[model samples]
Target: MKYLLLLLPVFLFAKFASNESCKSCHPIIYEEFQKARHSHASLFKDPIHKAAWLISPDYKKKKYTCAKCHTPTDEKLLASFDYKQTIMPDINSTAQKDGVACAYCHRIKSIENNETQNINIISKKEHVYFGNLKDTIKNPFHKTANNKRFQNGNVCIGCHSHYRNKYGTNICSTNEHNELDSANCVSCHMPKVAGTPSNMKKRKQHAYHGFAGIHNDITMLSRYISVEILRGIDRFFIAINNLSPHALTLHPMRVMQLQVSVIRDKNVTNFKSKNFVRILGVDNNMTTPWKAKEIVKNTSIKGNEKRVSTYMYKLKKGDIVNIRIGYYLLSKKVAKSLGLQNNKKVNRFILLKQKVFIIKPNSFAPLQQ
Candidate 1:
């Protein structure tokens, strides 16, 4: 089957074997994963699990996008982009799962290169992530080698750097190959979480079902963006104070997302267009006006403010933009559908923005400033 590539990485590569194969060498680790969420992440046979799917609005008790990351069992189920697989095995259960697996990220090549690089190239290890098997017994489904991109920042870029134009069009314009911001998946989603365990061995320990994302609260606050333009390096900074209270809200089966955008024209506002929107406070549990278009993408920060952060993309001197923050409480119905109903994690979304001015290269400040 043509395997589909999910943006997340799997467990580090290791030799493969059945549950029995793993017991011989990894006595403790095996015991851990044996009970690890992998066993049931994609098991459709569970009656309660199936029942929950029946009541879900989006999935009708079937598979959903979030479930794919939590429960990827076989690449075949995901390869087609089905978005409904109930059981996605834990690739991070071991190197065999390669975190998400050799299949997911490998299928995604450098979106910038316009080449068809697959797992062979994307799986290469790097300094950020040294993908090597310390040592392991050989298993068919598993392997131990230096996967250069295995733990590198590039692994998460596939999904993180998403954008939409003046229209609510989903564009994948990640800062790939653009190192100015030094932003990548891990930079935001997996920034070093203190006391989370950093030793290579520990990283492997946490690989199973412990994947990180834009959901970590402390990690997000720890990082900051300091913007300097060329008109000679005008210094401006912005911050996104995540509102979820937690890194990504508290929930097992929940929905969490953030979208920022650039607004160029107020007169061009087409309330009927999906791009226009009216902001809502956390108390109001409603969506944007159907007739209005909201700039639901990235937020902007002020270069002049000691630290400014807006939920919408900031406009350049002559630029225009708006920001929107969205959060959806993972209804018990939604969670039950994903088999995470019992996981009472509130799904939260927050966005902030400030004005951004376009300055010429190498100039310190905008002449007007």
Candidate 2:
């Protein structure tokens, strides 16, 4: 029957197909995907995820509800949780290693909204995958359908939007408005690079698969952010413009910092650095993800926000002002608790943007390069 024939390919792919299967046809994309954060999203592969999971409440019960987003390819792992059963994740399985596989993402038909979090609705038509191509190209492996969500990048909302703990406290949220009209996640994260989507077609450029983010390709993503300095008589304003659709930071663990220094006569005068973070807490104090009940403090820059900070330092002519904005994957306090205090990568202050401005005589603005 036609139905059985359609189901046959799905059954085969579900059991046999891995990312390796796509290598022969889409070698370039497959290589790029291997370097993506989605590929190493699992706890076993991602150190931060593993550390966080080990401390989470679900770890003791052997309930991996996070697998729904972290190891999405592991249907068995997800099914166990759905059945209200506790099962250890198979550490060696391809699903565990693959994390968010290409097949899993391409099959997403819709996103089901819920208070706890949004859910990804996989296509029942299994063999058919969705894409944003203007014209449908026949593929030997499966069928392709044009999806408006994929084209506009709304498809990413299923995982990247927000998360709230069982204690009714919002832990992490990228958007306060919960609307896509303000920003496009796809255009910023998956910008077109010099390559074709697949070997089956020839094109000048294709959507990058590395999934630019704080971990993977920070430089590429930093292009969306802008920094400006406005000078005054006794004070100067430094403004950070977040051009992205979501907050400057998506995770509560992450922290952004602004450092300013003035160089005069070869002597460096460092001003106090300001850190922007969203601190979750229980009662009135900072707490972990599981115990958090409310936001204690939030100084993070919002989506499409131009945040300005006024510095009262007086500037002299010919004084070189250095302004730098950077971030850390985790705050020093959180990193210490997570046993990542010694981690160079986590503790490293990743500079996003830097500017050197020299105060000019008689001119209100500095001579910036």
lDDT of 1: 0.34
Question: Candidate 2: lDDT over CA atoms?
Answer: 0.80
Candidate 1: where are CA atoms >4 Å away? 1-73, 79-143, 147-152, 163-168, 171-344, 347-369
Worst 10 residues of 2 by lDDT: 175-184
For 66-103, candidate 2 gives per-residue lDDT tens digits of 88888887867776787676667778778888888888
Model 2, residue 8: displacement in angstroms?
A: 14
RMSD of model 2 against the true structure: 3.9
Residue 249 of model 1, lDDT score: 29
Assess every candidate by TM-score: 0.36, 0.92
**lDDT at 105 for candidate 2?**
86
